[model samples]
Target: MVCRSVLLRSVAAAVLVASVSACSLWGGRAAKPVAAELGPNVAVLGVRQAWTARVGKIELPLELHVNGNVVTLASSDGVVAALDAKTGSDVWRAMLGEPLSTGPGSDGKTAAVVTRANALVALESGREKWRQQLPAQVFTPPLVAGGRVFVLSSDRSVAAYDGATGRRLWTQQRPGEPLVLRQAGVLLALGDTLVVGLSGRMVGMNPNTGVTQWELPLASPRGTNDVERLVELVGRVSRVGDSVCARAFQASVGCVNTARGAVAWTQVASGSEGIHGDDRAVFGTEGNGVVTAWSRVDGSRLWSMDRYKHRKLTAPLLLGRSIVFGDDSGTVHLVSRDDGAPLNRISTDGSGIAAAPAVASDTLVVVSRNGSVYGFRPD
Candidate 1:
């Protein structure tokens, strides 16, 4: 169980989960091994904490919705609050009084939160608007867009509901995998298309009709057993210009030509966390914690940094000229974006950052497992 728990977090870092064993899973392949050692961390980048707002205990990833200067976040205790991005002061707060299964989602208008009890609660202007019971537990954060809220549930289903009325608009489901990730696929909205990362591919769906515009194959299920073929798409997908990049939980990472609905390139590296890239290069942190940079055009390897090898890390985020990511020890590392080189670091709650640090307007925001949300600036 320890090995399963450690390796499941090896790269993907499942949301707010702590225990996993073969007995807990259907007959599946055993997880890959990981060393339980961590190297000494020395601070290089100096960061000053600007402000912090009290959020109740949070175990799952912190879902942050940043629109202009307003940032919204939800705690596991079901308190959703909107804060002033620059000041980190609470502008409004709403409590659902339920154990949150997923985090908060909003469009700077209607805010959404899900309960482990399989309920969806919507709030407007810090007031309860509506609540809807679902068929299964939600695994991904609610995505509010197009007058609808989108969420992926534990039963391999995707559903849309009216953001205002909690009315189910449409529901779609794919066949369940023999072995699937405990986490749900990430969802993105571009125009009228809802781009979703699924079991083994990425699909662009029509938000209005639930029809897929196109599907891009990311990985094919393979293995002697179920666990070997658990090819869930793990985290958020990156979109720069007309290209969209995604990583398969234990398979590979690659980018696609969104305009042409064609794959640009793929390389053989296993990771669950998605890549961070701009127009020229795409960056990834592998399952072994080795970070690499590749040519976004040709998928040719440019450089690789293994300083954090074997250390559990959260998803990497490219911030300005640096790549910033946090480790299991709650230490944040900054590496040069031009080439992967150690830059600076800072320590937080020491309970770890369960999610990728988000950029809210001019501030970098992180939610620690200890229920502390800090707003900081990187120099």
Candidate 2:
């Protein structure tokens, strides 16, 4: 009897171990995170700076807008300053309460500033035109279209007001979660529809009444709950001929049809929060340190180059025929857009180039993580 009892206990222990192993295998571990890389034949040659300026001491410089000879900057500290685009000199300054969340939207003469306090302030000649308050904080940059200024709140509500009078025109609420984990969405004005990207989905609504024109699912990775990651939609909603292009960085790039709300194609490239395109091609930096180009028509992979090892790339900036982007290590890379080949590289004195470089005609403006703005152009 004693022998029988011991044998029974051993068999039970073996069964338990087998059950645990099966659970471990079925629950699949998360995939290893890929690091950034640099492409081959890339050379680091120093470039000359045209100008540098201190905009003031702020935690984050939210937006940079260039208008004629004037450059406007909004900070997270509720300060807006207009600077001379050529000389980096101050033109005017305005102080608003609460942090400036989105960049300032302007209609040449008037500026619409969205605040973290859910207020939109209209400014002209360094004076307040009007202020309209909403129920939630504003995240994406406000769009000034059709003689109206549109502001998107965190609650997925789009509000439009008369640009000159601040008169409420329409308030359309897009279907969104009660709790949004990330700002990885865009408010784009394309023709009659206002486009917004949510978690695993994209919806186009009529700007007039806030009715859904079409809705489509953007294919994300099977297990990624992108909303929970708080990933902001960093790419612009660029209008390519009749189609619109945008990129999100949950697990891949979901290029979609703007008119039909259908995905044209999806790519496995990651860390593509910033996307820019030309007449023939689209360019962006992948999460794994690869700069790539894809055909805009069919979504075919054109060419890719790995330049650095495990360096996070900034958004792709179009400079003439070359694409420019900076990494976390203060290295700026300029690549030929024709074939995805590296052309030139420069090192900034700051810690890292976190923000996208601003290209104004012949001058390039870049901000460092250490709160310094540097301008460069070809000599």
Model 2, residue 95: distance off in Å is 3.1
Provide the global lDDT of candidate 1 against the true structure: 0.77
Candidate 2 regions with alpha-carbon error over 4 angstroms: 1-47, 57-63, 177-184, 200-202, 220-234, 257-262
Distance from true location, Cα of 124 in model 2, Å = 1.8
The total of clashing pairs for model 2 equals 12
lDDT of 1 at 270: 74
lDDT per residue for candidate 2 within 1-379, as digits (tens), equals 1222111211211210000011122344434445544445445434567887764343442445667766666666676777665766667778775676566766556777877566888888778888888666665667666677877666667778888889888887655433342232466677777776664466777777667788766543343432233333444544675566667544555567765656777676666456777667778877667778888777799888875545677778777877888877777788788776677877776478746676664677776665566777776
* Structure candidate 1, residue pairs in collision: 45-344, 45-345
Report clashes for each candidate as comma-separated counts. Answer: 2, 12
RMSD of 1: 4.6
Give the alpha-carbon lDDT of every model.
Answer: 0.77, 0.64
What RMSD, rounded to one decimal, does every model reach?
A: 4.6, 11.2
Give each model a TM-score.
Answer: 0.88, 0.78
* Cα lDDT over the full model 2: 0.64
